[model samples]
Target: MHTPADSAVAIQGLHKKFKESHALCGVDLQVRQGEVLGLLGPNGAGKTTLVKILTTLLKPDSGHVLVNGWNVTADPEKIRSTIGMAGQYSTVDGLLTGFENLYLIAKLRGVGRRTARRNAEDLLARFRLSGVAGRPAGTYSGGMRRRLDLAAALVGSPPLVVLDEPTTGLDPESRLDTWDAVGELVAGGTTILLTTQYLEEADRLADRITVIDAGRVVADGTSDELKAAAGNRLVVCVAEDHQLDAAARAAARATGVTPMVDRRARRVEAAASDGPAALGRALTALEDEGVQVLEIGLSRSTLDDVFLGLTGRARHRAA
Candidate 1:
């Protein structure tokens, strides 16, 4: 039996398909209690399908999914009782006022009338929606609607929360607001499973990340770990038009790697195993070759680089 001290969400040999399109293929993952696990993939990578199965909205064709020690298929009701979810799109009722929406959910969850009212008010305040709590949800901006949707999900104070692209289509400020709200939830001991297209969001929020590609698990690790797996850092140098070839040769010699020259950017870049030490050597080589450096910098692999390295394609590339 799983416990709160163990995995909050676990899947083994999971597979799902819709007619000819395979959504998940032999997928396996575990989200530890009180930890944020980011699910990342390109479009059609089955992120939404996985979230649906966990929330009891969809049944997996083949797999074992356990939520807080309860089998998803065998005890869906029990699983639902422990999870809160906010999807990519807002689930808020357009005609209902913000406070009314939250109150309705609280009441449905068997909260007392007085406690429901208090919870509704507190949620509105927490989401910064109190000023317009009486207004119809349809009248709110995209950001406000998202905040309300997330607040509604938290009305029962569930121990597990599933957030699927919760910050999609929000302004920068509102995205940060949602990030702060997520942090608060984690602080209160909620385990989160987040699916997002935003690498920076995953970097900032998730303790670990699972990346899927072509309906299969391609990579899983902490941000730094994945970045490290993407291979060595690179030092890039831009040279004056006449010195471009010379700089490229110098960089290749310094790093002992083939250099890629960007004609449009007037830049030359080569992988460097020694990071700053490689940069020092490259600068010396450039000076020896009489290459006039316009700009020079060392850059480590980012999550994007890691994703591309594993998937053989960029995240925005359609599956």
Candidate 2:
């Protein structure tokens, strides 16, 4: 068993309530030191509440909680000092230059004027914001502003960073840029609790993922482990859109599972119990039905499948 001493963040029997809504119910979670832990859940899944508690923004009704070896309720100030938070919305002032934002945050963290300036400069360089550091943050692109916000969060070199959907509403290119920035943080051994709607982001960055639903953790494991437990996937692509129905039926028949159809991709996928054997059967069925097959394969399950299996929300190609 792991103790709070060994964990970057730990909670047991955590509960939170708001009016008649039970936001979190007996939720237990742990994030190891130096690991990126992806906190995943649907909307109202207590993700934000849990983050709030961990970051000292909110208190849990009843539970034992610790961050960086400090009790959350007893040492809320200490916990706050060790955590850096970047939420979905940009928090930087539009009127301030990127350097000013970071510098101000550094000063707020209680560093001396000289140290604060140095810290701001270092962070800007670290996050690739130095070239535009002098420009007003309002003039920065979405991705640049996000990078700036992230830089401000690191001003004091907090041990743990909490990112609550750091890439929301970003264009595809901007999203990729933010992912790269997060990757750099992971490489530097920062413990991160990241909550995101992008399943792919969790799959790419998280050393382990904790899935919560209805205010409780339903699954916790590495990406591969979660995907493996979800079962193998049988995928088939048809050459024509009209053949999609036939392909889906063939996959379902072979895998003994309902298939998910993606019309634009002309693809049908489902969980398969027998892997390669199911692929063979699917191939035979499609051939017999004269459906032109573009691609067919049996592979390990993706994070998308794991998410769908746990949440029961088939958000096709979850953004």
Per-model CA lDDT versus the true structure: 0.86, 0.88
lDDT of 1 by residue, 247-292 (tens): 8899988899788788888988776768888888988998899988
* 1-319: candidate 2 lDDT, tens digit per residue: 3687779988889999999999999988899899999988777788888888888889889998889999988999888888899976899999999999999998898999999999999999998999999999999999999999888777788889999888878898998999999999988888899987678888888999998888989899999999889878898988898888888888888998889899988889899978889888988998888899988888898887788889888533335
Sliding window of 10 residues with minimal summed lDDT for model 1: 231-240
Model 2: residues with Cα > 4 Å off, grouped in runs: 236-250, 261-267, 280-296, 316-319
How many pairs of residues collide in each model? 0, 0
In model 2, state the lDDT of residue 297. Answer: 89
RMSD values for the candidates in order, in angstroms, are: 2.9, 2.7
TM-score of each: 0.89, 0.89
